[model samples]
Target: MRRSILSAVTISSLVFALGACTPKPDQADNAAESFLESLSSHAEPGEFTDNPDQAQEEINSSWDSLQAEGLNTSLNNVRTNGNVATADFTMDWDLPGDRNFQYQSQMTLTKTQDDWTVRWQPTVMHPDLGANQHLELRTVPAEMATVVGSDGAALLQPGTRYRVFVDTSTGDLQSTMRQVAIELDAMRANDESVPSIDAEAKAKEAEQVDGEFSLLTLNQQQGLDLKNRMSRVEGLRFNEEQAMVRPDPNFAPDIMSRVSSVVEKDLEGSNGWKVVAATSEGSEVRELGGQDAQTAPSVDVSLSKKVQDAAQAAVDTRSDAKVMMVVMQPSTGGILAVAQTQKADEDGDAALMGQYPPGSTFKILTAFAGMQNQGLTPDSIVGCPGTQDIGGRIVANYNNFSLGNTALENAFAKSCNTTFAQVSTDLQPGQLQQTAKQFGLGVDFNIEGLDTITGSVPRGDVMLERTEAGYGQGLDLASPFGMAMVASTAASGRMPTPYLIGGPEHRTEAQGEDGNQLPKEQLDNLRRIMRSVVTSGSGSGVASAGEVYAKTGEAEINGGSHSWLTGYRGDLAFATLIVLGGGSEHATSVTNTFFQNLDGK
Candidate 1:
């Protein structure tokens, strides 16, 4: 009986010891899940480990070292034996380039004081990660794409150019930069193709930089020509690398620069850089186990080489003042040519962005408004006096020229300011505004690779303001491109929406129809009046270009006036502005040259 009782007691004690040593499977699973969830949450370190602050600090440091979009973890197959537990888990990281990096890891836990706790380690996230080691993302940039003009001609090509630099860390950087600048200036003085260098500015810029700093960029030919001279200078270094190249140095610099500048915000999804896993020191980088980078497609523009060359030459020959010219296809609204002289280029892209008084150019819309609202035809009788007081302001024609009791057609052909001003008093409010909208004035356009400004026309409330608007003066502002569209509208009898890139399929929807907005008969009458201007009035100088219809404007400014001409020949429409060119006659001369050259006459 005694032996039996002793054996029973021993068995009971053995069962109690085993129960204390082994942990339940459900408890181990709960601990594993809590540990994985804690990775992305703010769980207290003591809740999962013995070393509270150290474990928290380690987790925070690991997370901070990694650059990823997001992280996900899941635990499964949990098992426990004695006081130890193990769980199989998967860790997935969402990275750039639409990639997901995944790996399997095992988590270990221990039962302490009747609670299951996870053993914290960096390897829990990544098996290979060690102390002072972390995961990093490295991006490999894709090859740049070229820009092609009409007919697959290369407009911008990727090639190698030279950069002149000064070694700031090694020698007298400022003095070296100044010497290089002097050499560049001397070369530029003798060679027109060499770009200018400012010695003082170069010295100042060198002082703000460290190590090797670039002073100027030169084309391959230019760099080769100056290599011997540049080599003689101390502390000057020449580095050659890939850069954007153009066949002609100044072939649409502003527009091409916008296309070649690669930035993060504008990078297309399929053509973007690839993100990869790398060591903390960025020595070994491996693809996040994903596909390679895709090739970027080229961009095609609508610029015609013949028209652009001709337009550029015509503007470049002018030494008197700034000039800008724009050419377009009236039917499709395709911008074929945009040219500006050096003087105009210094003032930015004035051909597409300048805001100047339209002068007599606005008369086109005013005439349409008059016929639509006041029931006036092109032949309606109106008086053209030398000077007339209109709503407390005196208005007159150019040089106070006038013809008494003249027809409206003659007044429009001669650009009589007083006659249009008088006629403006008869139209209703917003009449001119409504008419101008039909001609694409005050409308926004979205061209793929171009920045532009159309024009603006205010609603004149008082009689004087209204009268001023009638002759294109009061609060009427337009760019050369805007006025070109106006001419296109008159030619095609539809509001023209211009585009610099893409084809007809990319054009924006029409704003409004000409026939729906303005009277068809009146439009025909306006066309005739424009033809008369070229045939018998201020625009007569350009009439030799063959059936050309045009309007001439001398917009009055502080010093003098800006010369303006908007016209069309056959299917082509054009606009030109000579900044402060004195009178409409100069604009007429520019128009003559443009049309004469356009027709190769």
Candidate 2:
């Protein structure tokens, strides 16, 4: 009876599979060519213009530039069968002067109007020369089974599981199979192993595979387990059928770099030297072999689409100069999007990566540290004259604002530099450094694609001079990224790890040699003080973000204009920097634009 049931089920499944097979290769190719033609119609011509002769010349110039390099590419054959245009080309492949054989590439070009373009293909360009030597242009079948969320988005959001299958026919195509295996091997080298679904084939093979053994499996045993797991679930099967589990390409690039970045930054000297691969989604590194996992995701702060629209509008309002804008999610440290006009080559990224003097923003850190070290509340009274001498240097309050004798909180609100400098005299040098370090100063928080500058702090007897450093003076240089770290640390009640990408859970196998965790009480102290700075401090000028904690700075760097605003909202921390290429108005206007757009989520 059992044998009868198994046979019946197997026969029924085979009949169904035969009926639902994917489209024929020729049909798939036709569909892909048609899609490419449609895409070419909207392809923006890139840098191409109305002048046909100029466009052709530009293409020749681009090719000439490639020829100047050691690698050579020549078009040998071109054939068009309907929309499918195939081009065979050879490249003179010589690596580091050794004579290597030229390779042939078969390219399918979809003709849209007069120009034949390679579409939906991986364009391989030599890294040093920046020349496209070959392209394997093929249409990805529309029926290709892909995992999507309930809403049909990519399987990127949380709680989404993907299906995996191994195509037995792939083994027959040696070149394609080997290439696929190589790519998968490179991906699995990362600590965050993407799970695979080819267990059944593995059980029969005698030789060991190169990639993540823990992830891939054979079809019989593992496939049965996986199939059973999926069969038990309702609505989890592919909308079609026989969809194989492959690493989604979109996530592959991010996952490949995610772990490596962490190992490069945090674990550099020790076992990091031995690390073959690492994974970092922006900043948080997924350590392999049970190493220390990141406590938080890296900060990804970019303009939302709505804000980008607003920023474009703002740029349109201006004609002569460029407009640069940045938007950041204070919570989770994720940069949403970065948008800018063509005029500004730098973009408002200078606001984040550019280093500048802190000016008065330093007062917030100073006052917080002084108050904390002295065991003095914000209301603790301190005297302030128009000017005071500290470490043989005379410091005057901003605009010489004198509060006579007043509480520290009132002094802070008034932006009285004299009171702050005097208060700094009480705290030792070690105390101030410790305070700054807590705010992620003087330490590298690895942000991919951006350079970070750790603002300066005095080494020794500058403790008297250190008071001025508190008021955004005396060698304190910081980037927008650094300030955001300070604010996020203040907001999260701990330093939340800043990152750009998310997902693929981090597994910590073991703690590092330094076994360090951000102390709870220290984070609390930062929160309390930073909260006060926003509610009733000099930063109140920019406190329109509704119950936000912030600090503002206007630094004088010789002749350059640098203004700063750093703040935190809930778990989100951000810093906005405005640098004036001309004057202070540049800084102030940028700041105003930033605050004007700060409608928090």
Candidate 3:
């Protein structure tokens, strides 16, 4: 009996000791990994959690409130104290706009029999969270800045807009056409820049369209007026919004379109955001983290509202031809205005982009080449015949005009085609093209907010082509913007880097770089030669507008001619073109009106 009792006691004691041994190291680690995986997956923490419902609720709430695109979690370090364990974990929340938020916190788990389960607690999600606390992400909007012009006045201002629409299939589309047309006509009358709409045409086009069709967008006051006018009109709808708009739509329409795209993002400043602890009602309970919104600064552009208005008015005077103009500040190379008549607008950005034969204007470059490469001065005598044969090509002045043997300045003023043709054909292959670059032609400018191409002068290796190019006909092509640069160069005696964005830091070098400044003696002589054109020659039409030094050109095409005038007065340099508008006098007349309008202001 004693022996049996001793054996039972010893076996029972041994079994008890084995049952109370320390837990396996991988036991708590596996449980922590399982809980983290569930939380990161936004799934229910079924077996690994003590209170599965609470754990699942908190996980889902956090994911939604934080607007997390994705969540990743990891088990950091675990410490076991008998049946209770503390596991350090990290949660990485991926937010919108490529933002990320990461935090390290501890989760509590208790061993129940053979299994370890996570405990339900707000601190398990975030160390800063309290009981019944919720997580939230908040955003603050930023105010956009206005674009200012050279006059330091708002050019493109932030304004309230309403994009008005109509469901063509919802109402009597055909019957309502007249009223809509009347309303649009009223808008046009109020703001002539507002495009005219054809209601009947729109109705006809919407015949097969069963969806919404946008009619027009109006400003706050204009929208109010429209609402009052179309209050009872069925199928009418509006989308309220904010955007940048030109106060005077007639002011440099082409340039405004180009500038809007480049400056749109820059106008909206930094937006503020915050992560906060909130209540069930979505109100802030405690501060978590975030940055305040920063207001965007004003954007200054290299344009003058006053100058633009004048230029637009001047260009509008011509309706029979496609007329365009580009004006720049000679001293700074800042664009002042771009203006185009109705016909020119139809051709798309011709004021700064249309490439055409530049006629007598090519003589300007040829004459410069003569001075720079051929040792010809303004006082040198050059021959001018009614018609001259060079390189087997016959070059003649307009109507075969002739000025037999005259001073270089006189020949230039008279626009003697033969004289310039001879000079151009006599030069080395690359001489003319190189000289053109010195005057801002044949180069490219990556001007912020402006898309422009300086004129092109091909290698004049072939004598016949060079002869024709010298007279501004054969392979020569230039836009109004290019000619403006040339005029500005002559005005300042060096090529000024042109820019649309005005600031100390935004200035940049133009493409196809080369020598910047030209010889002062030659430029001075060139200036004198240009002045003679206005005082007594082809450009005399604009002579009343002060000492307007200029060059007049008439490019001959198959059926007609293109008129051109490029020059400067005071600090304003400009170029004017009239497509198929015969005679340089028309261009000179247009230029005179532009200057006069500026003065009248």
Candidate 4:
């Protein structure tokens, strides 16, 4: 009985040791092979793979350093009662070469009959691409129309929709009409308000009606030519719109370019309506949308022959420039007639798109910030040897000459950089950036395709550079649109929200409900200074038509210069930028031309 009991004890001890030696199924899978299968299934094609040997080699090659870099893997939970089991694990590692990026992955795997499988949400995992990443190019609720200004009239009109009959072999007018009607019914069912034309009736009647597309004649070859003209355009197509025919071939490219943009697209089309591809210059035939569908009421602008002659004269002499001559109503800010040297359709880049250095024009902003934030006065005296050392760097006045001892007015009149830089340093650094933001610098304009660059003030070496930068020297960059905002803000005394879209618009909700966009007091402070500049300061070179408030700037660089002028005449605010890549005289010359024209107008 003693020997039997000893034998049982020995067997029981052996059984316990065997159980301890065997691993849990989950622990066996978590050893690295399972991880390779799980990661490879979900990884992008370029980076991760399924081969355990390869993965081990990659990790092993850098294992010692990776271990030091705190690369870790942790197993959280494992269940293995049934044939299928679940394992949860996490991997954390620093990317090899890139310090800026760190990766962490949590994986949960379900054991299949033969292998482990993973589930991933591609949309959530990769948000930067796939269907969710793109902005849908949706069709507008209704066909988009255009607002056009001609003579003195502003016309808003709906566009025409036409289907050209290129092949007579396809059908007669009645059959084509029937086809058009069927398609029209189908289109209306899909989108309730699609407009359709009666090709059969139009072929019979031939009268041009308002809000209706007229049937026009085109041969098969003519249709092919038209299609070729419209090959590059998408969304809304054109067989025909308005056409201008000129005798001179040289003028055709210019005319075609202009007319193409104003053409409207119809709702049913795959491409926008545009000019028929043709270079013909005199009395070319094409279709236009009927008058009634237009949004703005068409009115004839009655300009005197004298005004027309003057406009023509302005165009004739300024042939080289891409000009956009805007005549606006000061009281309402309604642009009257915006005439350009090119055709009606080619609205050139300069209209609201041009950008240039603001030069001394920006000094008014520094001056205002100085007075409001640092308790500076217009009469305050600044030591202007015309140059000074700023934080171990020397900054010189505009002409590099001494004004000796000067008051604020004299310093401003002389466009003194030293005074501006000193003032910039005295004010809080944050104040300059904040004030510029307040005036809409770095903000996008509502106008499509135009970018407004907000000027930046530097911090360390850049900051000292920006002290001179305030006068448009170091790190000063601005768009004409941005400069206009600054000028308008200074002119109006409140930070005026500038818009290319015109209106007697009221102030935003952030301001008081009174729609007093600018404060009377702020306007008073800036107005006096700007008026002083226009009359007797740096801007005095430009003759003012009335009580014009302005400032002129000259930015000199290593090889060239950019000149600037921004000001307000009555309620009309404007900013001009010119770059003359060589002599300083060229910079001033261009500015003087604009000023001369502005004064004459």
Candidate 5:
């Protein structure tokens, strides 16, 4: 009986030992899965590896090389032999563009300390990978995108341009180099944005080169102009290459400057947008892998070529003072033209960026405010004295000329400072600001690929400040573009949101819902007053354009006056600013000329 009991115990102990010697398939599969999970999640590999730190370093180096959005791995056909175990695992990489890349890799797990652990090796990622070899990424440049106009014409096109080079081996080195620099400066004198070349730097560059040294790249027209002049001069050569070109070199350079280049640095790591290739550096093993780079789509703008050319010609003729002219279509709010001339005081895009008092031009908003808040009409009687005083400050009309006791229409038409100033005292606080907002003044704009300053009308506290605000002075400031919209609002009844790109989709909403649209009655009265300005007031000079509505301003500054004229001719609403160009008379003359040229007269 003792021998039989001992045999049973021995048999049971042997069965338990056999179970301990062999690990279940689930245990080996779980261990392999744990290692892959750690790698995919960028977690420490200590739980499933012999050397956790080394395994982590290996994973860190090879992870980005995969270049995948997601990695899905599964263990299949797992088998174990003695202390060594093997599993055939399939790895599926979710790349960009709904594409998938898959490969089969064998995982080797060793039994250590009675636990299954994956043996770390570079070959675990790919069978061909070596210890020193690492994956490298390369980018291929995509095709360039074109900028198109509203007419569906290519605004910018790929064309040949020339870069001027100097042969250091020939000619008078010092004299020729200096003359070349002078000629380049003369060519670019009209554009203040162009940087002047340094003659000393050119000389140094010439010394460093044995054969040919490049100076500057120029457009076809620019190169052609310089080629003839430089042909007679020695050591000059022209190297031609393909580049982006516009129909007119100065055609909206500010707006086009924001367009992306073909070889853009910003698109380097953007998946699917750029072509990415994986390569092995040391082993000379390379695989061409990545989605083909997509060309950037062209942008269509609302600029009118006819209007832009005319405006450019008018502004380009002047070299005396800074001039900016902005034209917009009242019905559609499409910006037709933005033209500026080179000047001594020119800083930036003055059409959208400059801030100056609107002078009498701001009276449009003042007159609107009076109509909205003061129950005043075109026929309302108002006193227009030559001068008036408020808070110890004297306000006078242009040259102190005023028609005493005239209708409000005449006061607005004649731009009587005293009449408007006196009426302003009756306005409630914030009345002028509310009126300005209704006219699209002091409203923020978000035109794509463009920056604009849309006038500023601060709240008037005292009687004097409110009175000044009435006549477009004393803390009232606006841009030519902003004033253009003010004229457009009066023309269209509803204040049209100005846009250069994407049309109505890019229209900027007004600050307040009340300011979005004006009453038709108010706009009608405003139109009558503006028309009188052209027919009988300061803007009579532009009357030849036939039934024109206009307002003229002479904004006072340190040295002189900034002449401003804003009006609409037919479907076009426009604003013109001549920086420090005498008074409204100068702006009036420019306006007349602009209209005549616009009509092809």
Candidate 6:
């Protein structure tokens, strides 16, 4: 609002009116347009403005702070009142980055002696633009949205991460790395939520770098602890950044890290800009106009917080070995959880990509091959000898344990190596390989936001190789992810497509569209046999939890054996593995604890 104040003044000199005719309305409009053109060009308008020199000075002084690219003006309307006229015009300000600011304001023009001149005033720039004021553009960033899980629970939110690194100049690099891991572990024990690092890999990478190399990125509390504890350590540095992070540090840290890398750009929306009227002192007076930024949408993942916590806790029980467990929903093929202990993290997501001999778990495929090719049934009698020679290589049961002659179901439950070895030897090459793919093993899923490699089943013409492959001894390999798929196929009859992200554009599609489906009756019989393994055989450790179906295995490697268990209970199909964890009982115990914890919840 404009106000008028009364003040008494004495006239110093008398002025005489010029004998000139009033200019037309068109002349006023044209003069007003010329004045705007002068403002844009930062120059004085000749003979078109009452005070061109004063307007030129105001244009340069007021608009200098705007840093505008250019200005455009259009005359809206012009009203004539004898010698004085009002011209309403709109100004379009071209700003940086293809942005524009537009507003309507009015200017006055005086007519005398057949000439119309624009009368200068701050209001010509903007209606609310005050004296000694100019327009300034400022950009404001929008807030990132939360990343939710399948249950609509928050999985990740906007947060800060501090990357800590080490300089190789530090004395005794290996000893320093060991100490760093120890101190970091101590800090994590205090919070019980900090994510763990691959210390051995981090050390090896640092050794290859010249000056400094990053070790790990920690959440807020973890970073603060590092500063308080290790800031004084020589050759250590820290850098921080705003990032999307998991709320529960203990809930699938490594998996969530991978998720963040894929969804970060989508979560950060476009930035908004506004034009504000400011005084010469750069103090904002009022907002002229601007657009607001669109709200950024949240990301959704397939992880269940309750299930992930349970699996993570189950694996954390033993920190001695690299224990990993992958759980899947057979009905929808959603990845329920990918949990690994700190020791397992050192192997860089071995649960999804690491391949190892599956031991007796391979019997699942061998048994299916027998049923499909040899027309065998669960009630069919099979030989379970202590030791048997098939074409040259000798296949023996664990400690040469013999069950004599037994039903196929009982032999499967007992994980009879000799019996399955004989069954595999009977089938031709590529038969087991085809059966493996039918069970979702050895098939590439090409999942989005996640990289995975299913296990491998070889096609060899040699009888000994086929015999060893039957018991998962010679050239069979399966990752936890692949084994989990096998268990899912067993439960669902056909292999369900796996996906970590829920949206179709960011999801894992059905890559096995042309893959074979398991025979229903035979699969039912297999499921029954797998249940018996849990009911009265090798998987008895988890029998108390529920009607869990499973196959237990201990593949003998160089130093020790890899514990393996793959099966399903209800909608949850899973595979648990422990590298060099000795026996399948260790994997079974972990699975039991996982189920117990889940059921307890």
Provide the overall lDDT of each model, using Cα atoms, as 2-decimal numbers: 0.73, 0.46, 0.83, 0.45, 0.74, 0.82
By lDDT, the better pick of 2 and 3 is: 3
- How would the candidate models be sorted by TM-score, starting from the highest? 6, 3, 1, 5, 4, 2
Worst 10 residues of 6 by lDDT: 2-11
What ordering of candidates by lDDT runs from best to worst?
3, 6, 5, 1, 2, 4
Candidate with maximal lDDT? 3
Tens digits of lDDT, candidate 6, 373-432: 999899999999999878878888999999999999999998999999999999999899
RMSD of 1: 11.5
Model 1: residue 307 alpha-carbon error in angstroms: 2.6
Give the range where candidate 4 is weakest over 10 consecutive residues by summed lDDT.
5-14
lDDT of each residue in 1-601, candidate 4, tens digit only = 1111010000011121346468434432443234433333323221222334433333333222222233334444554545444444443332223221122333334445655543322221112212212111111133343333333322333333334432332324455445545555555564433345665674454233223333343223333443464343332133544332212212223222333342322212232221111112222133211112223322222222232233334443445543333232233323222234453125344434444455677787777777667766667787677679877768787668777777776677667878887888776656766556555554444321122343544442456755766777777667555666666566555444332222222211222112135445545666777778767776665544566777777777665676566666666555555443332233234334544554475
lDDT of 1 by residue, 1-601 (tens): 1111010000011121356467434576677766666664434543587556766766654455444555667664677797898877776766554566777777678888689888866566567656544455545555556667764677776677888777777667666766666677877776555787777777777788877778788888778766777666677777888776776666776766665562212223254333333454655444434445564567567676667877887777675579999988887777888999889988888999899998997788888788878888878998999888887779988889879888888988899998888777667767787777788776667775677887887776766668888888877899999889888888888876677666454455444434233457887988988999988888888877899888989889788888999988877888989999878888778777876676787
Better of 2 and 5 by TM-score: 5
Clash pairs for candidate 1: none
Please give, for residues 240-325, the per-residue lDDT of candidate 3 as tens digits: 89888888776776677777887888799999888888877787888777768897899889899988888878878897789988
TM-score of 6: 0.80
lDDT of 5 by residue, 246-344 (tens): 766667776666532422332233334222222344234644344566666665567877777778777766667788888888887878888888772
Question: By summed lDDT, which 10 consecutive residues of candidate 5 come out lowest?
Answer: 4-13
Clashing pairs in 3: none
- Candidates' TM-scores? 0.67, 0.46, 0.72, 0.47, 0.65, 0.80
The alpha-carbon deviation from the true structure for residue 311 of candidate 3, after best TM-score superposition, in angstroms, is: 1.4
